[model samples]
Target: MKRILLACSSGMSTSLLVTKMQAYARSIGDEAEIWAVGQDKAKEGLKSADVVLIGPQMSFLKEELQKEAEPLQITVDVIDMMAYGMADGKRAYEQALSLMENK
Candidate 1:
C-alpha cells in the first residue's frame, strides 16, 4: 500500500481533502494510507510517506519539504490550484499516484 501525505500550515485545512481522498481510495479499492499534517510535522510525516502533497497555502514550503523528503526518496509536490480549490479527490489521488509512479 502507498502512503501519501498532505501538508498545510496547520494540517486542519487539509483534513477535509484527506477525507475526500480516502473516499476516492475506497471507491477504487486502493489501500493507500492518506493523511495530513502541519508544516512543522511534515518532516516527521515524510519518514513514512511515499509521496507528499503540499496545500496551496503552504506551497512556499515545498522547497524545504522537498529537501527533507529527497533523502527519504519521497516525491513532494504542490496540489493543483483548481483541483485543490474544488476539493477534487479523484484528481488529487491521481496526482499522488502519478508522482509515485514517476518518482
Candidate 2:
C-alpha cells in the first residue's frame, strides 16, 4: 500500500481532500494509506509516508520542507491548484505516484 502525507497551512482544506483521495483509492482498488495534516505535523507523519504533497497556498515553504523531507526519501510536490480546489482524489493519487516514480 502506498502512504501519502498531505499538508496545508492549517490542514483544513487538505483534510477535506483526504476524503477524496481515499474515495478514489477505493474506486480504483488502490491500496493506499493516506492522511492529511497541517505543515507542522507533516514530519512526524512523514516517517511512515511513501509520499508527501503540499498545498499550493503554502508554496513558500516548499524549499524548507524539501530539506526536512530529504532524509525520509519520499517524493514531495505541491498539489495543483485546480486539482486541489476541486478535491480530485484520483488526480492527487496520480500526482503522488508520479512524484514517487521520479524520486
Candidate 3:
C-alpha cells in the first residue's frame, strides 16, 4: 500500500479531499494509507509518507517540504489548483501515483 500525505496550513482544509481520495482508492481496489496534517506536523508526517501533496493554499511550503522529502526519496508537490478547488480526488490521487512512478 502507498502512503500519501496531504498538508495545508491547518490540516483541516484537506480532510475532505482525503475522504474523496479514499473513496477513489476504494473504487479501484487500491490499498493506500492517506492522511492530512498541518504545516507544523508535516515534517514528522513525511517520515512515514510515500508522497506528500500540499494544498494549493500551502504552495509556498512545497520547496521546503521537497527539501525534507528529498533525503527520504519521497515526492513532494503542490496539488493542482483546479483539482484542489473542485476537490477532484481522482486527479490528485493520480498525481501522487505519477510522482511516485517517476521518482
Candidate 4:
C-alpha cells in the first residue's frame, strides 16, 4: 500500500477531502493508506509517509516542507488548487504518485 499524507493549516478542510479521496481510491481498487493532518501533526508523524501533500492554504510551506522531508526521502507538493477545491481525488492521487516516482 502507498502512504499518502495531506496537510493544511488547521487540517480541518483537508480532512474532509481525505474522506472523499479515500472513497474514490476504494472505488478504483487503489490501495493507498491516506492520512490528513495539521502542519504540526505532520512534523510528528511524517516518518511513516511516502509523500507529503500540502493544501493550498498551506502552499507557501512547500519549500520548508520539502527540506524537512529530505531525510525521509519523501516527495512533497502543493495540491493543485482547482482540483482540490473541486475535490478531485484521482487527479491529486496521480499527481502525488508522479511526483514521488520522478523524485
Instruction: Write down the lDDT of every candidate, Cα atoms only.
Output: 0.91, 0.86, 0.93, 0.84
RMSD of each: 0.8, 1.1, 0.6, 1.2
**Per-model TM values vs. the true structure:** 0.96, 0.93, 0.97, 0.91
lDDT, residue 68, candidate 2: 77
Identify the candidate with maximal TM-score: 3
Best by lDDT: 3
Q: For model 4, how does the per-residue alpha-carbon lDDT over 1-103 read when each residue is reduced to its tens digit? A: 9888999887887876788778878898989898899888876656889998899988788898888889989888888897689888878887877887888
lDDT of 2 by residue, 10-93 (tens): 889898789989988889898898898898887677787888899998888778778877987876789988889899888888
Model 3, 1-103: lDDT tens digits are: 9999999999998999999999999999999999999989999999999999999888888899899889999999999887788888999999999999999
Worst 10 residues of 2 by lDDT: 39-48
Q: Residue-wise lDDT of candidate 1 within 1-103, one digit each (tens)?
A: 9899998899998888899999999999999899999989988999989999999988888898899888789999999887788888889999999999998
Per model, state how many residue pairs clash. 0, 0, 0, 0
Cα displacement (angstroms), candidate 3, residue 88, comes to 0.9
Better of 1 and 3 by TM-score: 3
Instruction: Using lDDT as the measure, name the better of candidate 1 and candidate 3.
Output: 3
Off by over 4 Å in 1: none
Q: What ranking emerges by lDDT with the best candidate at the front?
A: 3, 1, 2, 4
